[model samples]
Target: MMLNANLWWHDVDVVRRPPLEGDTDADIVIVGAGYTGLWTAYYLRKLDPTRNVLVVEAGHAGWGASGRNGGWCSAELPVGIGTLASKYGRSQALAMRQAGREAVNEIGRVIAEEDIECGWRKDGTIWLARNEPQRARLMAKLAEEREYDIGEGPTPVDPADLAVPGLLAAAHTPHCAALHPAKLAVGLAGAAVRHGVRIVEETRALEVRPGMVLTDRGQITARVVVQATEAYSGLLPGQIRRVLPLTSRVIATEPIPDALWRHIGWPGRATMSDQSLMFPYLQRTSDNRLVIGGRSIGYRYGAVPRTNHRDDERAWEVLEREIPTMFPALADIPISHRWSGVLGVHRDWQPRVTYDLATGLASAGGYVGDGVALSNLAGRTLAALITGTDSPANRLCWVGPPGRRWEPEPLPYLAIQAITALTALVDTRESRTGGSTGLAARLMGIAGK
Candidate 1:
């Protein structure tokens, strides 16, 4: 199997849309036709059919992280609820949580209304704790959620029922769903078109100016310009330090037989992950294949973003080893695919949706690795702000002025490397000692806040 080929694109044949010809004009010109841009375009047209919305893409729609992610349409935010409360306020934090849960349902509703068969399932998520240290962390998290009176926070599940080996404890949250990411991206693009939004594929957006977007094909003048180029934001001029691009890799196994599934039971098909600092996330695909991903390849020097990382042998090796360790029943299963994608991470690790009415500029991203569900919310908020629609989404915590830009090059590169190394070290130490690493708490404070 090709390491760079996305598993989700295995059976889907994608036809590129016509690129923009010469100069053009639109009510909204959005750069990068990933989830954020496409959703924004979809909502813009839905909210006001008269508005001319144009989305220019470097490649086919969803070619970025949107199509290549872990297939988790989860309500999990890049920052935790407690983190949000401390930074904003308790009510605002709760609202953000509610928005996330609502976003999950909103996506499902859109998928159904569009009749897009993308293997959508609302089976929820299960987070396992394989060691005592990890269990402690999960317990503490549950305690915090209860203290805040968060709605139906994760509840404990018996490890024996999950069938995963060495699971000391498990917590399941009903706020997530697993689906084919590429299918959703392609579906959204089709939906946007049906809603009268113009999308130009294979047209690279060179730069986003105040009221215009300069592309490789030509210039597009618009009343409002949006930069929706998540991880690739660093590649744009004047946005080199805006968001650090962190690489995460994935490996998918061949379909597991029914007999093997009995030994590794996840009949609910819920997305699963462990509580380790540098853990892996897994999901049972609609086709019965087990897809596991994580073990970040860290950030590249100069914050450069690329489509392929064929040199990520170490990360791939780690993931390959992880599958068998987690589910011994899959020890003989062959990994059918391997791929990597970059996700945007803000300095404070909080995603944002910002619109500046003065410059007619709007942006949304920095989702870390949680863009699937959050992007939908961001798109609605962006549309509301652009179309002057009175929506509560416009008041979410993520809708505001952009946060601080990441520190210049070498600094961010070094910091990411240090953090990655510390994460691995903490997990390894905890696994060996079966005790909490006091440093884990401090590391979370630094990495998250």
Candidate 2:
């Protein structure tokens, strides 16, 4: 049940403490000490080092997807601006969007400034195409990128140029990056401690009544409470409804040959993914292993560990079969480690920051799978929102909640399952057919609804 790096954010040491045994007070109280909460403290201390900030976690720090994720520090390409603009507004969307891009830069800056060695990479992202429709979409998307002003070439990389098999094309993006996730988390926790932020692990926030957060062994009073729990937002009131969770799985191949690395010309050995709705993502570790994973939408977010455990064969099955399909030279590599984590897929697939100014209670969630970059950006932004600072965090486009209600169609859980199954079935099947899923596939994309 411990959510440490038994997954692939690589290894790191997290400080563990027993539950709070009594009362505490701080200027800020952050719940769920993953990437989001920790960054909240890290930045808060940066802006005002003298203030007391308490970070409480249900588990160890970064033990959630922050520790277990694929380690790709990417921008908000996964979610379209249409989603962004609709929820928050053009300026806010642009700011939120820019913040995600800045998040990666901030990470590198943090590592260098603080000298935290987290295997950070500034290479880029390559999204492979399984079939021609996917390839054509990339070609179109690359062209589309110019229109959206996502900077330079999201252009297609010919499969022939790499002498790889199976893949027809890959949209190579030079702006993205990767990192050793858990290492960054532990380092930040250490860094935050240096700045007077108090972090307590294994301390669950049992209840929140405006200024006081009650836990089993202790309670902390604050003028403002920020809930940074991304995956397990269900623990907080009204949070679970904001983000619809999808359990995504990842597996690392034992390590490919140096020959393969040379072929890919992975500049800084960047992170990569595919365009499939069930996105197949791959990135090279500092040690040369290729870690890849895709979505099995049929599985609920919470069941990833149990449903896709290493021995179940699907872990290796998905990676082995899918990795080489994206990069055929990697077709023979064996898997060494495998893990899964639940990601909060915010409705409309946009990252949202919501706070009731009257209540001074805020919750940040719904990064979809863009938590690595978006979460950090959101954490800092949430802190600024709470402190009433004019920091760039709030300038980002995604600054508020969905500000809507979930009109549950038929039932809650059952409807979600059926939609997931249908979407996966149609998406995977259409992917095999090689082009866009057409109108039928488009409609099925909402099967969960």
TM-score of each: 0.97, 0.88
For model 2, name the residue pairs that clash.
92-397, 93-397, 95-396, 95-397, 96-396, 96-397, 133-435, 247-301, 419-447, 419-448
**What overall lDDT goes with each candidate model?**
0.87, 0.69
Mind giving the per-residue lDDT tens digits that candidate 2 earns over 1-449? 22212544445555675667689898889898788888889888888777789999888887787887788888754566544555556655566556667888888888798887877888888777667766765665565456456455466676665544566777677667777778878888888878888888888888876888888768899988888877576555544455555666777766667877888665357677766655666778877877776656434433222244443355446556766655666666666666667777554555678776777788777776677877778777877777778876675556765545333433444766766566566556757676465744454234221
Candidate 1 displacement at residue 117 in angstroms? 1.2
Candidate 2 global TM-score: 0.88
The sequence of per-residue lDDT tens digits that candidate 1 reaches over residues 260-298 is 877777776899998888779898898999999995556
- How close to the true structure is residue 341 of candidate 1, measured as C-alpha lDDT? 89
Give the least accurate 10-residue stretch of model 2, judged by summed lDDT.
297-306
RMSD of each: 1.3, 3.6
lDDT of 2 at 27: 81
Model 2 regions more than 4 Å off: 1-10, 85-93, 237-240, 264-267, 298-316, 405-415, 439-449
Q: Candidate 1, which segments miss by more than 4 Å at Cα?
A: 1-4, 307-311
lDDT of 1 at 144: 75
